[model samples]
Target: MLYIQEMHEGMKVAGIYLCKSRTAAVTKNGKNYDNVILMDKTGTIDAKIWEPDSAGIEEFDALEYVDVVGDVTKYNGNLQMSLKRARKAREGEYDPKEYLPTSDKNTEDMYKALLTFVDKVENPYLHKLLEKYFREDAAFAYRFKTASAAKTVHHSFIGGLLQHTLYVTNLCYYFTKYYPILNRDLLLTAAICHDIGKTVEISAFPENDYTDDGQLLGHIMIGAEMIHDTAKEIPGFPKKLESDLKHCILAHHGEYEFGSPKKPALAEALALNLADNADARLEFITELFKANMQKPDSEWFGFNRLLESNFRKTGDLNAL
Candidate 1:
């Protein structure tokens, strides 16, 4: 199978891919066209059917797997496809697994590593809270392990939420080591639970789009609510401790402009914010580099909205 990531300009594409989305539109010249996004485990590509009514084009909709024949072309420095033909793929013709992006790491191993952090929480209340979600809840554990962290940004593959959580937790653990004033249990617990809301925020693939709740309330708000409700169920859970933990989750984004409902008000909240932002931004850059591997190492990719600047690979210095 020709994965989206392996495609290049001037290549002929003829394969079965999941039609992530499709939209009808009219060109400025009054010609009609269909905008489509095709997906496989590697990634997604923007495609267009210039002649949607052509005999070669058959009925197909978003989220359906289709056999597509197209020519890869570059537009605005990005790869796109001009489709010649497309038809809904039969069930036996395509494997569903190939169409979903997944983390390179093993989900089971990552889940175990996450539990290790849960074990590290020394505060009795925090430990029980962590245990309730991480160790005891089988259904939630399955969703959390398989869910993506975001719709399109960093860590958008299966097992992404778990992988991002573990990375943030590890970073917070290191911060506690250097800054003894930070509450290790509080920070670590916040790190693990920080993105738990994401389990419901984004639906499981092959349609990893935002849920209605995700669009309305977002993961930050949902996560804070989750923490609050869970703590209420635990007997004698300290009110101050519950408030502190929710504060960390609510303020992890660090600013209102970034969608944080509250800014960091506690030492642990501040640490969680730094750790979450660092992991997310670094992973964004990492995925950017991977997607642009075909380009020359020294060539600047261009200005990225998320990075807020032009970016590119620093070519290997050892070869110099």
Candidate 2:
């Protein structure tokens, strides 16, 4: 079995992988090919099925497992597979869990750390609102521990939501410490609950695609509505506090172009936005470099709009 990270140009790979997606297309000269996404436990890679009509091609769809034989090639510094043969995997051929990546952090440890923040929240109404989702709600707790932060972004794996929430919550803790003006209770509570709607936004594993609500309202809107509903259930939850909390969730996206419904009107909202953006962008860059590590002396990493610079990871120029 060839781990995707170890693949190099012209290397042969044979393994059972999940067919994340498959798209048929034609080149400018009318040559047909298939653009596919293949996934194993490590990560996903872009694969081209040049011989889609070949005799060995399998009848399969995204989410199905298949045994694939391919030549590894580097495309713009990222590994891409050129499939020579593929067939739907039979029962006992592969374990589904092996095809899904999970956070290295312990889920239980992450959840318990989050609970400490919930305990320290001073505002009664905000505390209770967070409790409704994080502490008392058994089902939401179960899903949150298992859910991914995004279907394909930072923290998009099992235990990812918990890992990301822990990081953002920790960020808020330090933010409140540094800036005495920031609302510790409001920021911490908002941190824990900001992405709660993502539980419903994306489907559970093996098919972690967008749901109907995820596509229509998105996590930001759905999360705001969720907080509003929960705030109503709590007795004497201040209306203004409820509004501010929702503002944090809505404005957490930070900028209008990034889909934030509102800019960070409150200082606490701004803090949460920065924390969220930092975690997401850092994780994305880390994953990008991991995928491109095969080429040490590489030039530009193509067009990575997120990092803004294709920071070249050059080989040991110091060696010579």
Clashes per candidate, residues 3 or more apart or on different chains: 0, 0
TM-score result, candidate 1: 0.93
In order of appearance, the predictions have TM-scores of 0.93, 0.89
Model 2: weakest 10-residue lDDT segment is: 311-320
* lDDT at residue 223 of model 2 (Cα atoms): 93
Minimal lDDT window, size 10, model 1: 311-320
lDDT of 1 at 72: 100
- lDDT tens readout by residue for model 1, 1-320: 88898898999999999999999999999999999999999899999999999999999999999999999999997899999999999989998989898898999999999999999999999999999999899999999999999999899999999999999999999999999989999999999999999988999898899999999999999999999999998999999999999999999999999999999999999999999999999989888877767666457878898789998568642332
lDDT of 2: 0.87
Q: Give the alpha-carbon lDDT of every model.
A: 0.93, 0.87
Model 1 stretches astray by more than 4 angstroms: 28-31, 296-299, 315-320
